[model samples]
Target: MHRRRSVVLTALTALVAIYSLVPLFWLVVNATKTQQGLLSSFGLWFGDGKFALLDNIRQTLTYDDGVFVRWLGNTLLYVVAGAGGATLLATLGGYGLAKFDFPGKRAVFAVVIGAVAVPGTALAVPTFLMFSRMGLTNTPWSVIIPSLVSPFGLYLMWTFAAQAVPDEMLEAARIDGAGEFRTFFRVSAPLLGPGIVTVLLFTVVATWNNYFLPLIMLKDPRWYPLTIGLNSWNDQAQTVGGQAVFNLVITGSLLTILPLLAAFLLLQRYWQSGLAAGSVKE
Candidate 1:
């Protein structure tokens, strides 16, 4: 019976993996095909067309005087500043909520919870209006500022810090003449490795894939992220006289995902450890 269950579970797991990977596999297979090949060929397999991947990549990077490169740079800038800031603020906020006691503590938790419960879409119009009033619209700061406030990230870190960092350890640190900042940096920070990486991964992915916010916030093509840029390329193909650059779009998409894949591969260990710590009860 146990062997039967194991086999069933394994099959289900395999199915889930395949389901998750099919689009990626399709993207990889299609990225190698030319525009004509994409139209004429089977999606899951390579086409008879000459491998235009290198050519496509060159075009993607060099087209319109290398606008794609600028978009990529803009994306990186947003991810670094937005995601990094979100992680920092979440960590500090979460740690404070977990360890420190002050007035409005419960109220703060309620506010965080309420914020998390509200979808970002609901806040988008207000955010836009506020930014426009501040004259931050069409600027990188608009995107970065909104991205910095990650309620979910803060909540995750709050739960993680509460469980992972013991009151006893904090008391001992205090007893040892370690300053609050020093204790956090020297002692608590090491233990927070998994949670920090988890929050970082979340924020990074969110910032990297952010489209609607950047779409509404930024007007300049120079400040567009890869998500919006790729969509523009896709949209161009839709116009009556627009250039058919699906091959470049596919290749650019392939290029766009590579960094995220690398990030996941590198940080996967910490992410898994974080899940473990977050899941199990003491």
Candidate 2:
């Protein structure tokens, strides 16, 4: 009976996995087809195997004065500056909150938790207003500065640090004449390895996928990220017939997902380990 139940569960999981991946599979298959083939071919199956992927990619990059490349560069910049800065800030903030004690510590922690509960979308209007007042509304900084404050990432890091980093290890490092910062960098940082990767991946993915803040803050297409760029393609698809932008949109979506996929694949092991560490500890 137990074995039968296990088999049933496995089958259900497989079914769910396939259901989730079917659209992705279709996107990949369709991305390799031409505009005509995309419209005519069976979406789930390979279309004509004539290898239009290179052509599609070339056209995608060349479209609208090479706007796609600009968007890609902007996305990379946002991810590196926003998410990378967020992760570093989260690490320091989380480490401090987790390891140190001072006046109003509980109040500070409560504020961190409150910040996490607030959705980023809810802050977009206020952020835009503030940036607008500063004359930064149309610049990349308008999007990036807001992205750097990842309250969720900070909370995750705090939780991970509290559990993963041993006080004894910190004490030992201190006894050997390491400063608090040195101890954190040399000892706690290494032990928080899995957590750091988890936070970095989460922060990077979040910033990379962010649309609303950029939508409100940026007025320039030249500084738009992939998310906004795709939205532009979608808008053009609504009116432009000869543009063949529907195919471009679909293909561009497939291309846009690759970096996220690569990031997850590269850091999946760390995420798994982080989860295990988090779960097993509690």
Find the candidate with the highest TM-score and give its number.
1
Q: What tens-digit string does per-residue lDDT give for candidate 1 at 148-225?
A: 999999999999899889999999999999999999998888778899999999999999999899989988998999
Measured over all alpha carbons after superposition, the RMSD of each candidate to the real structure, in angstroms, is 2.3, 2.5
Winning candidate number (lDDT):
1
Predicted structure 2: lDDT: 0.88
Residue 149 of model 1 has an lDDT of: 98
lDDT of 2 by residue, 116-201 (tens): 89998989998888888899998989988998898888898888899889898889998999998888878898778887888899
Q: Provide the lowest-lDDT 10-residue window in model 2.
A: 273-282
State the TM-score for model 2: 0.92
* lDDT values for all models: 0.91, 0.88
